[model samples]
Target: MAGRKITKKVVKFLKLYYFFLFNIFKLNYVLNKQYKIIFLLLIPNKHNTPPTQAFKKLLNVQIVLNIYIKEHLGGVIHELFYSRNS
Candidate 1:
């Protein structure tokens, strides 16, 4: 029973991973080159959620941090743009 549950989870994760990959291919024109970096960073092991939700959470945090930086740093914020691909 426990083994069956584990198998189901593995199957579900593979489905999700493939689904994201398919969407990534379909949206290639719309995706930035840095996207694969984000995707790779969220690859799961023993203690993480799937990449899809993890990437969304990362974006949310990034947005909040950008807002905070702009508010706190004022004009210097314009020079703070950093490229992840760099």
Candidate 2:
């Protein structure tokens, strides 16, 4: 019975983890699309100035977010597998 309870808990944890991971990926995709749209819209015409510093900052933010997501997913996977083995 105790082993069954542990199995249920592991199953629940996996479900929640996958759900969270899915949302993160979905959010990343949406954000990337938005960034592309914004980049296109910000492009200057022949008579106009280039995109502003604010857009450069936004790009930096996107890079950081991507790095963070990668690290977070790696850490989560490591913890899940490590715990399973122990």
Candidate 3:
């Protein structure tokens, strides 16, 4: 139906827009760690309840762990985390 076609077009447009936004945010984060906008790419929505909120908190924890491991334990961390096997 026509509605289905319109919905597909809208979804495609949103996907492309988000891709562009992701690149901009990525460049900004790479240029300055203090920006922290990269986290926005990870956390898609804002919610204060269980499940979603807990997932967001866990993501933040993982981010901290990744940074700590990369900076403080750079040499000891596994190759899987550091570099591509190829």
Candidate 4:
């Protein structure tokens, strides 16, 4: 991509990725901290629900904060679906 000529479609793809992939990596960095901040999704009876189901339930109720920059913030969803193993 550096030395060769790229078509307009490829250029658009690269631009989109370049702008978005950085925030994706940053969000992964933050969400990966969930294991450390484990209390946010704590339930009284861990065994009452299956691990994956409990994780899915938490995802539905909990909001993920995404602060792209100082003034820009919103929820980043895993709401398509979520699962975790115990």
State how far residue 28 of model 4 sits from its true place (Å). 0.6
lDDT of 1 at 82: 25
The TM-score of candidate 2 is 0.47
Model 2 stretches astray by more than 4 angstroms: 1-23, 31-49
At residue 38, candidate 3 shows an lDDT of: 57
Task: Tell me the tens digit of each residue's lDDT in model 4 across 1-86.
Answer: 64443364456556655786788768756775673357444665656666777666555543443333312321222221122211
How do the predictions measure up, each by TM-score? 0.31, 0.47, 0.29, 0.36
Q: Is candidate 2 or candidate 3 better by TM-score?
A: 2
User: What digit string (tens of lDDT, one per residue) describes model 3 on residues 17-81?
Assistant: 56656665565456345434555456556565566675566567657755754464335333433
lDDT on C-alpha atoms for all candidate structures: 0.54, 0.76, 0.55, 0.50
Q: Model 1 residue 84 lDDT?
A: 21
Task: Choose 1 or 4, whichever is better by TM-score.
Answer: 4
Ranking by lDDT: 2, 3, 1, 4
Q: Which one wins on TM-score? A: 2
Using lDDT as the measure, which candidate wins? 2
Please report, as a residue range, the 10-residue window in candidate 4 with the lowest summed lDDT. 77-86
Give the TM-score (vs. native) of candidate 1.
0.31
Model 1, range 33-69, lDDT digits (tens) per residue? 3554665566565565666777786676556655654
- Give per-candidate clash totals: 0, 0, 0, 0
